[model samples]
Target: MSKRTAILQTAAANTDAATEALDLALAMASMDQSVQLILASEAVNCISDNPSKRYAMLELLEAEPILVFTDEPLSNPHQLDIEIISSQQLAPQLNSYNEVLQFS
Candidate 1:
């Protein structure tokens, strides 16, 4: 069975790390690896209205479902669409992955 991967994106919006994390996730997903893209803290900004082509390409790749760890969804000024997960869910969810790549 393919190993499950959790790509934890911790970079702030518009930063290179954020894009790199997405690119890495995309690459892994293309290889038929099970991938979960999780955005943490300010990295959540990378999801929406950001000036990154990768965000649009996210739909082209079957990498989801993307997840966000937060008590409540933010105002979402940037607007990358994904599920909002509670803190309690984060640990169990991350533990489910076979590997985790955190991009700070």
Candidate 2:
């Protein structure tokens, strides 16, 4: 199996950039690749705000990527993989991925 991983970080309000990146990640991960999402700043809101419209958009994707947070709480049941990570610790863990995608 071909294995790949991507790290996406976003800190936007509309979240258009993050959403697009997630769609791309889902497409990539659907092909047996591993994927992870890094939430920071304002983007972290998406993970903890109970159920939002975008949450469904993310969950509907075929590939379920792991969700990593920095100073963010993990409370969503739909989140397949969730963890709290520090900004300093993020880089080393991110290095393991074959691919890394960052967005603002």
Residue-level lDDT for 103 in candidate 2: 74
Model 2 / residue 85 / CA error / Å: 1.1
Per-residue CA lDDT of candidate 2, range 1-104, in tens?
Answer: 54556656675635677677666666665554566666666667666665345445444554554456565445666564456777777778778777778877
lDDT of 1 by residue, 9-68 (tens): 988977788878888888887787788889888886665434466664555677677788
Instruction: Provide the clash count, candidate 2.
Output: 0
Clashes of each: 3, 0
Clashes of 1: 3
| Sequence-dependent TM-score of model 2 | 0.68
Q: Which parts of model 1 are misplaced by more than 4 Å?
A: 48-51, 75-81
Against the unseen true structure, what C-alpha lDDT does each candidate score?
Answer: 0.78, 0.62
Model 1 quality (TM-score): 0.83
Best TM-score among the predictions, by candidate number: 1
What range of 10 consecutive residues in model 2 has the weakest lDDT sum? 50-59
